[model samples]
Target chain A: MLTYFVTETNWLNFISSLVSQYRVFGLIDYEGELKWRRLNEANSHSITITKYRSIQPIKKFFFPVKEEVTAEPSAQKTILIGCKNCDLNHLKTTDSMFVGSPVSDPYYLKRRENTIIISSDCDDFRKTCFCTSMDEDPFPSKGFDINLSPTRGGFIVEIATKTAEQLISVRKHYFQDPQPILLQEREKMRKRITELVKNNNSELNWTDPQRIVSSTYNSKAWDDDIASTCVECDACRFVCGTCYCFILSETKDIWSRIRTWDSCQSAGYARVAGGGNPKNTRAKRLKNFYACKLVYRKENFGFYACTGCGRCIEVCQGKIDIRQSLAKLKKLEKNV
Target chain B: MFKSPYKSIKAELLEVIEETSNIKTFVLKPEEKFSFVTGQFVELSIPGVGEAPFTPSSSPFKTDKIDVTIMKAGYVTEALHNLKGGETLGIRGPYGRGYPVEELNKKDVLIVGGGVGMAPLRSFLLTLLEQKEKFGRIILCYGSRTPEDVVYKYLFPEWKKVKGLEIMQSVDKCPVGEWDETVGLVTCLLDKVKVDLAKTVSVVCGPPIMMKFSTTKLLDVGFKPQNIYLSMEANMSCGLGKCGHCQLGHHFICKDGPVFTYEQIKNIPEPFA
Candidate 1:
């Protein structure tokens, strides 16, 4: 790991150089919420890197909400910063789905090839954050070109790729070789934040998510308890970092086939041409979400699709907490 | 972009035959050579409309022209039904695992089809007919809503001539003096199909309910679960299995199978659904 200490001002200068060279998308605090915005020279001057993942999952950059599958999209050299571990980790699920496992999606492959990822350690986490419950760390140990940890008057920049070293540019003189004290501070910060996240999820009843989820397929909670509360606004899926289902829509003239975000919750999602819908009921649709994330994705990716980023909980219109649902599913295991 | 999987090959409409009130067979000549296995399907697209999946009714041996039997079921199919002839359409993918022809070799092959499900079975039957000496026996039991609803009527005579092949058809309720064959569900034909239960392999494709019942009957007669192949063609989008619309439990119906054995999908939740 190439570690360096750059004062907050010099870090801003380095971002300015990056913005001048390539299109930069970084998390910026907007109205008390972090939103990903393009970094211009002016915005780069005051860029505050929030370790919190944006409500939008980083998958949107690679597999867009809507894109023509056959057409070539403009692939610009880009830098994405302020990514949390949740954002970087979820890409593995999406990558395995889109990248060539016999057939590859070119639109997704092009964007994945062109962009650089800059992750940061989460010194703080939202109340709904439960990365610890999902068996993931709040801080990223890898899967990034560059990483940042905030300290008192400066940031400890740790880069893991050659591209990240080149990004330092003329501002390379600004980084001072870090002392041993800096590494000690980073270790302490990581432990404190991890403990805080674990403690937040201390009330979670289950530890083995896969076993609990697979056993709850026949649970009545989906139709009886959960379906009544859900209005099917699709907010939870939209904000989810790992939801990769999409529908192919044709343009008016049918020239371009557009792949738009699709939710399994939609009634038409599994409906056949002759109007046979396998997941016809809202209850079945609700069950499908858990089945895909907790069961299917885990089998395919060898990890749970839910990174415990809590964007689903925060953006949910029905006040449905996934943690509460998992507890309900666990209750099925007991009754059986 | 090396030939996007989504890119459609231009196919000129060569002929359109009205098979039923709502069903039509469009003979398409692809701009380039295209061939698909009997049980595999293609996404046919009208330039101004959209695409829907359909299995080729013609033989896999014929690559110069493909005969697609389409019914007016949904938006895309409605437009496909409206096409006359000589209009160009877009065709992509002969997707999914087609009928395991090799697996059926030398085994008694029983085809059970309902309504337009006969489309793909026609292709499969024709393929078997091309090499008739290889298989033990081939039986086709097809049922439609009524006499008017039955498709591919003209081919029955030609199909009946093949040695070691038997054809039995039924209509739910045919008009008086219009039909002579057995007047019952297609599953009724399974009762009369005298094949070695141990050596017979049955293929079923139909409405969800018919397939469900047919599968039960096949199991009742002691056909092995692995020998009962089912064609599940429902809710497929982006036929490459990436779009995730065609998921049945963990399996993508468009990818892992449009053709799956009962043993492969029996435990999956509502396999017939």
Candidate 2:
């Protein structure tokens, strides 16, 4: 509820100042695609507030792809920016994984404790975006330390919790009381944001989230749905926000053991040691993708693992559109 | 031993019994006494290799010693085979719900085992024998691939001498000069044992395919699905259920089970379907 603003001209400079003092991670152009990359003085000027979720999810910042969760020591501190609401929703799911009972993962705990999340509003929704259908708005709800929204001539800022207030206190002069005109601009921008989200959702109404769970279990539609083009390359899992299946490899040379990110889409993801794979077929693997996203995760963690950021669709070699697949599943269930 | 959160205790191998050509039984005695109920399993770790879940084949009554029979199917078991007496290993549990022994007291017991699956069932049988006066009748139907694959041949004769206990073993194919038991499938031996379906509880342990067929046969013989129990195995990388590797639908085969009743899991797809 504590709101403030920064001038549009000084937005990049403010980010640069934050970068100078912290190990900042900001949205950077990785070969023309927006991804969260390590930010430094040289890269801070090029960082921009993207209108859509990045190609990689926020899990990259928390649960790194190749991190040793049981490392002898642990990881380092970081501050990240330009995260959209869809990304924040996915972070809440990842929190349950690393922080599960009996013991907390030291590696994930270190990285999480040291990282500061700076969430921003989506200035534009991407073409494949369906976050609204997944109950995710472009604006963050509660978990972020600081929230940012763009205004006509500047950026509207809000601090939610003590962590954010402490961060803003580090640079008090940049803070200012809100002028009435600036307050009015934020109200108008919020309305515009809602309208944009509503329109995007209507366009995406063809794909249904509710049916993604109910129909994929034993449907013949999925046999054709997960076409021969799947290739089982596992790029979809790499790009997904909540695909947390991992394999434990013994690296006794360094440590007792290490668990690394494993993709369910891989041929051997569910294979036992003696070579029995329950989800061997592409159809079963495709079904697992839906069940893990819509059913198992919700039943276990009370949240849908998919944020509808459309990264899986963007990265699939098979061009398997998740929205289209869910729509097909809905139609198939209706026929039944 | 008293239970504590993630306690690492040292245990020594008192004896090693070769059960089959590729499987061995490591009898461990902890420096301190530890007691557990039947059907509960412990996490056995070889310092350099990794940890795996296995049930103690020894009786719960004998707290001073335990036996863990392991097949040489994976890395952990391979390391376990190389260990000798006085070698130290780490243990984590007597975790998950053990067999419903309180509910099972004073009732007839039917045990079905195949391959290395006999290990856990043996623990249940030994525990039952300690309370032999409380139970009415105990029947064991065990099967193996061939004569060379049979487990614990030394204990069969002593078990046969136990009053009111009927043990029937079978081999898929018996070799020459090594034959002395009923031949054919384990299910075929079911006809020989007289079980009053309503008064008995049956526990089955085996490979998935064998368990599936055994369940069907038990049902045909009028045993209620709820009266039957099954010990299931999965790749339990972390026995606490946080790892997600051991998930079967909503249940983690590690925590929710390595033992589950047929009625509890019949609806889950591909769970021994």
Candidate 3:
């Protein structure tokens, strides 16, 4: 519960000073949208804390899209800033996948141990946002080294872990006693974010994701509603926060085998060498995505694989909205 | 080359019989002792090649040796076909839940198998023959694409010597000179056997299509789904449950089952679908 203040005007200087002492990364403007980029002391002035989540998950930093898992590990000390609650939650899911078994993945472990994370509050919401339905707030309440709450005139920062305490000591000039007025301003921001999420509930209604999964087992709604325009490009899986399907490929015939992400949406994902695919139809494949996220992952891993990050909505080429697909599945349940 | 659930035992290949153009049977004996329950499978590996799961065709009571029958269907099996006698290879496991022997107590057993599907069931047949006095009548129905594909061809006379056991074999066609049994599908043999459905246990294994048709025929004869068991074969990279490749929904074929009763997973979508 350690609190401090950084004025809105000097927030850039505060971030710049921290960047000089630590390897820092933060959300920055990429083209027109926000994405994570390396932060240097000179460019910290341009970093934004308002975007709820980036287009790519923080996983790109932890587990790269394609990494040499078999190579000798080399991970640099780094800090990731501006991570949202949903992004942090997805990282926890990846943690177990990397660390759960005796054959722990050294590639993920090397980066995880050496990196520190600083999460900022979600001060705004997008039309596609629905973290509330997934029971996650846009803001991170815990599981962060440092928590930032944006206020009208300044930022209310709370140090969470010992790593954050070390960070605060190096930037002691930015600290000020937490004033009641600034605290009130941050509370109002939190309230507005919650209200925006609540108001957006109708757009995300899917009539209980569990029933949609069970009833759509052999439903024709998949072909009729979703499959016609699928194109099978695998964009949905790429943008998903919890899709962990990978194919371990032999690389360059020399360096060790590497696991690359594969999508159930792809035509070849489930095929064996002898050319037998249990899931062959587009309808069958689309149904698998829902089943994996809502039923199979919960039954096996005890966690809903989807964090409602809404990245899929932004990336789909067919204009397929995941929220609408679930809603349609819910409506088709009665006919089944 | 890769870690598997069972440790490698130094074993020599006693014989390799070309059962068919695409399948062969290797009879192996470990330099040391290795014992397993009937109906359990072992992981066989060839150095510099991959590993695959194969059930021992020989009865488990014969501890000094193991006989594995393999079909050259995929990567590892192709490597297994090239190995000669006295070559060193890895072996692990006798894993997965085997046949429920207790449930077969005093009950007539119907063993249905197709082509190389007889490999695992052969272990059960040999064990049942040894303990001939414990069970009711034993009936074996085996079918293959041709007479040449019918495995364990030399053991017919020995099995016939058992008083209460019946072995009915069929080939798709006799191929001119080999005409000693019925023709057409193996399900046609069900007409000749009499069974009390409530007091019978049936084990069927084969290619997915054969198993599907055999199971439907068995159910038509009033066999309970719980009493009908089937073996599932997926490309298993790791014999342990660590790898997700062998998964059928939430169940891993390597660990949860290579053998599962129809009642346990009748409703799981996709592979069972």
Candidate 4:
């Protein structure tokens, strides 16, 4: 809850100071897309805080697209900036999948332990963003070390953990105690962005995703329009923040084992070695994906797997919109 | 510095028995004493090839060496079958819940296996035999494509000699004079057998289609869903449960099962598939 004021120039200097010790990555808005780029002391000044999350989730930092499971993942001390609340909240699912499982993934755990997350508020909104619909705010309240709230001339840095406090302690000159009016400004910015997200998603209806998904388990919508458009490219799964499925492969000489991202959207995901797949068809596979995201995950992990980032909608190969699928399944008489 | 569970432990192939044309039983001597309960499986690997999950057909009581019965069906199994003997292989696991031996004590245990599905059951059967006096009648009904495709033909005589155990056999068809046993569907044996349905528990393992038909047959023959056990198989990549390949609805087969009761998973769609 402790808030501080860091001017635009002071904030850059503070980030630059840490470059000698930590590998700092900041959001660089370029070519109409916001991407995470490594920051040295020189490039730290060029780091631009974005209003939304990047196309890549924070998971790629922990669970890479491919890694050698046979060796140790580099446990480099690092800091990540420009993480939105949607990006931070998605870790609830990924953390449990990687760290809280019966056997933890060593690579993911190592990276998680070594990284310090600095998330930011969404001063702007994306058309596809629907965090408000999933009971999430545009700003982070937890699962972050420090959160930056963009105000008129600077960022309102809210320190949440001892690590953040200690990290800030070394560069105390860059920060000043926030004025009462600046605190109000941060809250106002948050409210405006939340409203923007809500308005953008107002047209799409399923208030209770859990109920709607369960009721539509046997709906004709799955086999109807969905079957034709779904090419099963697995783009949605690969870009998702919560899809943690992976497959293991051996090197040609068997000297190493590589763990690569695998998606259930693929036909052979649940196939047995003997040529039997429970989710054989595209319809069955798509149903499984939705059931896991909305119903089964909540049943097992006590939370929905979808992060509400709307990345799936953007990256979908077949131009299939999940919102349309829900609308098709929705009965006019019942909200579900 | 935490060690990854994906890494397979070195194990030397001590011996190999050619069970049939495609089916083979491998006896492995792991560098360490790898112990597992009955019905639990291990990820076996052929050095330069790949890994596949299989239940140890050897007795759980035997820790010095492990036995796995593999049919040459896929890439890894094909590589495994090509090995004669005395080749170094890799293994990881002893994952998933094994058979509920404590629950089966003093109760009649009926085992239904189809073809290579008999591999995991052999471990469960051996465990029961070791303490056969502690349980009631143990019945095994097995069916294969033909007499030639039957695995562990050498063990049937030894099993018949054991007290409190009854074994039956069936084949899909008889090729002229190739067979002389029960020639019909395995479900026929399920119908003919006089089991005290009230006190019996059944464990079924086979190919997907066979598992489906046998489960329906068990239900029809007066067996309760809770009493029937099924050895479910999916594409299990990481035996430690992090990789999500072997999911059966909300439960991961590698962690929550490989062994599940019919009552536990009857609700999941295409569970046997």
Q: Is candidate 2 or candidate 4 better by DockQ?
A: 4
Check candidate 1 and list the clashing pairs. Answer: none
lDDT of 1 by residue, A1-336 (tens): 889987888777777878877889988877657888899978877655855777778888888888787666568898998999999888878888888755888888888888998888998888889888888999998889988887767878888988878766556787888877888998999899999999998988887767786787777778888676788888888888888899887777565687899998888888888788889988899878987888888877788888889998898778888888888778788775
lDDT of 4 at B57: 94
Which DockQ-derived CAPRI band holds candidate 2?
acceptable
Ranking by TM-score: 4, 1, 2, 3
Relative to the unseen true structure, what is the Cα RMSD of model 2? 3.6
How close is candidate 2 at the interface, in terms of C-alpha RMSD after superposing the true interface residues? 4.8
| Candidate 3 lDDT tens digits, B150-256 | 77777777887778989898887766767678898888877677888878899888877788888889988898899998887665544455344556776767667
Candidate 2 wrongly placed segments (more than 4 Å): A8-17, A30-32, A69-75, A179-212, A252-255, A334-336, B1-15, B28-38, B42-51, B60-66, B75-97, B102-108, B131-137, B175-182, B191-199
TM-score of chain B of each: 0.97, 0.93, 0.92, 0.97
Tell me the TM-score of model 1.
Answer: 0.96
Candidate 3 lDDT for residue B11: 65
Residue B118 in model 3: shift from native, Å? 2.8
Superposed by TM-score, candidate 4 places the C-alpha of residue A326 at a distance from the truth, in angstroms, of: 1.6
Q: lDDT tens string, model 4, B100-209?
A: 99998789999999999999999999999998988898999999989988999999889889878998899999877777668897887898788998889999988888
Better of 2 and 4 by lDDT: 4
The best candidate in terms of DockQ: 4
**Least well predicted 10-residue stretch by lDDT in candidate 4 chain A:** A327-336
lDDT of 3 by residue, A68-106 (tens): 544567788888878888888787667755654434566
How good is the docking of model 3, by CAPRI class? incorrect
List iRMS for all predictions.
Answer: 1.6, 4.8, 5.7, 1.5
lDDT of 2 at A120: 86
Note the DockQ of each predicted structure. Answer: 0.66, 0.35, 0.19, 0.70
Backbone clash numbers for all candidates listed: 0, 1, 2, 0
